[model samples]
Target chain A: MSALDSVPTAVSRPELRAGEMLAEGGEGRVYELVGRPGTLYKAYRRPAQLAPLEALIAWEARLAEAQPELAARVRAATAWPQAVVTQPGAAGGTAAGLLLPRAPRRFAVRHRDGTSRLATLSYLTADPGQRAAAYGLALPAPVSADRIGIVYALARVLEAFQRAAPPVGHGDLSTRNILWSLERGPEVFLLDCDSCERYSPDGEALDSGHRRRAMTPNWDDPATPAGANPTLASDRYSLGLIFLRVVGAAHFPLQRRQRDSELLSIDFAIPPAARRTRSLLDGAVVWSVCARSLSTRDPARRPAAAEWVSALEEVLDGLGAMSAARAVWAAQGGGTPAPSPTRSAEQAADVRVRPVAMSGAGRRWERVRPPGPGLPALPQSTRPAPPAAAPTRTAAPAPLPAPPSIVELARTGLGRGGELWLGAHRATLASLSRAGRRRRATRQVIGCLVLDFALLAVIFYMCAMVAGVLLGI
Target chain B: MVNVEERYAVFPFYLCLDASASMAGTPMESVNRQLPLLRAAVGEDPAVAEVIRFGVVTFDDVAHTTLPLSDLSLVEAVPTVVAAGRTSYAAAFDHLRQTIEDDYHASRGKGDRWYRPAVIFVSDGRPTDDRERWQSAHSRLTDTGWKRHPNILSFGFGDADPAVLAHVSECKPHRAFIAAEGAEPATVVPELLAGLIQSIVSSSASVYSGEAQLVPPEVPSMTPIPVDELD
Candidate 1:
């Protein structure tokens, strides 16, 4: 098949054509256009902003060409800058349009306050039921294992992309930017490509004097102060948030708010474990990621995508292993059998007691076991037979050991001058004192006597000299 | 001679990073550049190459597993580090703990013995959410003797809480935490990552050799920033 054939032709027919302007962007007019096929197009009218957009497009295209593998993972540009007729007396020049891919299907979840939050796949897939179905299998109840595996897999993908050395980025990486595909899994596509810049591995700009306007506030990192250009680390911060939301967890690290609000707010709480076997490792991993990425008041502490990919992979591997183990447990007889609702009530009390005792043993095993059932029922084969009559046996008594005094030592070292002993040895101190020889006489007293003698001599001499001079006169 | 079977099971290293809005500008760029260099250096050593697996987890307002643990050889390209969003340390930590716990259990199922895993957390800002859950999870790891108590090395990029990093690292007073002079991810990440990789490699090698003594490699020095100028 021809390379062009690989492109989906079903989208070729545009049913919507640009009839009138819908909105004005800094660089272009967003027009509602109808095309040949029932496709609706947002025809962009080239504005003064087109120059920067054009540059970004060219740079992204070049990078994509240089690295085909990396480019393959990203959304392909449908059309490039093509000269087209424009209405007379437009702003700068003849209008040019670039056809882009349509966004994925999305829905908004309304909050109690009537505000709506866009519930994208990144957020929706995080729901346990949704996640289990999406992956096409019943995940172990202790979902930590599955989460770790997923994180690991994602990390691997990131690493592979990083190694490819493509100047590629998900310019607008948010829940909206991430699309789920049954075949390809989670695919990240770059949107607002015109506003994105090509970066070297060192984060230096390939093109100078180019800055794109910020797109969406929701997609931007909450920690960012107002009116700041998004940095590479900022993108990482956003990516981290996306990961947490996708993994069926509670709350984003940074809460989204209006631009005028405070940058930092610690309000959200993480979800509790559903199973004793469910390791909090997943939560820790997520926290560490967010902490490292978002905790740095300075953007520098955030790990690069390459670095994140590696770290995430490790976490996912752990999760995957846990899942596998859970699966094994289920397959074996180790899994707790489902309990009846009536029995579950009694089991609840048992659970409360067991957890308290288990906590002392430093094992979360009780938590991992299926809930609503008392501890695993003892197997009939393993149950001990009734104890036989005890036989009498004689034992010898042993002597008791003496108890030692328990005096608490003060944390502070020796007393006021005790600090001197930190570096100095007693022998060195004695030798220095002896060598100085100041102990033989009272130096202060001797010096005073010498000063007194000198003063008396000076006074007597001065008086005699003055008397002689007066007599001669 | 020591057999391969008797060699220590190399624990994978995961660096769950916070790349939120707080880590923009210098910090993100520093980390991005440092990651590749670290991988290259680690890959150069045959011993490290055989045992150490690396991955990255980046969090912002939301936590996501950007890089899952994989062999170093699998990474063909470097990831572009972008800074955006808020700090979500708590969620990221939870994710890390869950992932590690799962892996430990799975390894046991396969009859694979595991060495204590290590997580090096680098962040510049504070968590933008409740951290109690993360703290509890961290405590659980220590109490459970799970994978050699999962070494947690935390570095504060700039203006980060030393106490938090210490609490996460669970290392002794002087060894558990590192504070970066500036918020440049590029500068701090390399230094921190080098130490992490070095520690893992040395620890694993010592375990394999039955020496019980593993001297950590010298950490790369950070570009000195004048103390007076930091303010």
Candidate 2:
């Protein structure tokens, strides 16, 4: 009742006469507010009024009066709680949902022939981002650079959100929450701010516990206690997974025979799926930060959101995509050897069939499904989920990881905490150290092998030059 | 100037299947079995997996989307589509029209970079509905004056006419596949589906590599079901 008194309570309760239903999610249905342009009302399905949400709602109301600029920024970055919709239903215009502002123009696309479509981030992954609406290319093929740009946009938004006044943590951060637009610079609309974690400056608690929302099991960190809430560190882990998705989306790392459960993980030891991703990301500073460093299951070990911002900004500057990728090398001490040349499609295809391929048990295509006793019985969740609507590709969710920073890997050496986390694969760090040593030796051997090839190539060129000279005479 | 380089969205892929009575037994069974395999294969082939959304439209007496355009990762088991009624190409097209307008090209319709959809249509018999209705639906699907229309790759088996299949394939005779007469659909259907997967992969790969054209693989057991042959 005190919380109700604090919020703008309705005298007679607002009626929904106009405006159609825009979209529905885990929280409630959002309806375009009639008469009042650029605003939408969300009416929750659940009438239960909880205390945690009351504090969050009160904080938002206070922000509107106090730091409006910060509130505006929060709204721009995410659908921040603007006003609690009180529709006439049961006990006193119950706090149904919060009203959200309309998405920006950059959050949508227009067809060449003149039509517009709101674009979600899925355009970058599961759904092909290519279309004739590209306005320039008449023949239809997706542009490859755009996906990178979209991911880049995501990084910037997350950075902005994390740096906000009280600092918003997307409790449910995934591709589904971010709508994108290629019409301008990777413009996006961040949905469901109600579910986002917003702590009071005075340190009050807030949680959405969005279990009912569509979240892939792969996204959840196994280390976090079963009932514990997702933290900012978990958010970083999620971002890192996205970084991998962007890096390797062109060629997913799912081995031909690997199960979905195997795909869900937190260990960042360079899985086969990451090998090519590592190669493609070579030279980029963030690659070291993201692939080598931030991916660790250890939240303390992961870089803060601000660090990501600075690193990504540098990546986008006159370095990586600019000066022919010259300034894009690893962040100095991340001594992971520079990747070899970027391979062509043929080379990638060749690697797929190689007998001694992958650090794992080889390619997915090679795995023959074991029959009878050979295959162990799996738990029910591992079994495919039951029938539902067609799986919307744009809503693809989750990624797995747990890795060490190049700094820590060199310094503390996977720590006591990391050792316990590694469990059965406790020897992984030792093995990795051995592999690192082996890699050094192999690099030297490969260097000599390359030199030998170079010498032979020089001789052949010389012979050819002589032949050309003789022919001319 | 707006940065065109950053403008992009995922490629939308739709499968328009004919579940009319003619394909009831072996052909239908093969479809149910092989479709999941096709999806799994695509998942393994990253070239296509990253660039395309998978959707299905099955038509008999009516056309309904067994699956809306969905993320492949979200896809689990293929719904066992039971065969019934008559082939209504028009109904299928109309349903797609509604889906595109309401779902695909809704409120936020079309500024992102999207590859024109590539549709794979399979038929084992001729349209049971009125010719005008099918033609109207066909016209709407092929029309590009308003928005980008999808590219269709069609298959004709049994009594499904070569002319209609060619038409559905946008008169591209090369894209029309016809199974040999009297052949067991259980065997022939798998080959056709394999070819369809190849085309989908190639089309998606083109979005990145920019090398190949959107073309189907040459099916060993099937011949070209050209429109001229029927005419």
Q: Which ten residues in a row have the lowest lDDT in candidate 1 chain A?
A: A349-358
User: How accurate locally is residue A308 in candidate 1, as Cα lDDT from 0 to 100?
Assistant: 51
Worst 10 residues of 2 chain A by lDDT: A347-356
Positional deviation of A203 in candidate 2, in angstroms? 10
lDDT per residue (tens digit) for residues B100-156 in model 1: 665566556643455567676767777666555455545654555444456666667
- Model 2: per-residue lDDT, tens digit, A1-473? 44425754222235544388987765668888778677777778885353444545665555645555444444455665556555565675256666667777667545343545455443344223232212211221121334444555555556555555566567556555776655444444667766666644443334445333333333444334446676655566566556554422322232111222232222222334324442234444454455322233345455555455445544444223422112211211111112332222221111111111123332121112211321221110111111131222212112221265688666675476355444524343354457447765556556556755876898899999999999994
lDDT of 2 by residue, B31-102 (tens): 878888876666433335556677777887777666666545344445566687788887777566555544
DockQ of each: 0.02, 0.03
TM-score of each: 0.34, 0.42
Global lDDT of each candidate: 0.45, 0.54
TM-score of chain A of each: 0.45, 0.52
- What C-alpha lDDT does candidate 2 achieve relative to the native structure? 0.54
Chain A of candidate 1: what's the TM-score?
0.45
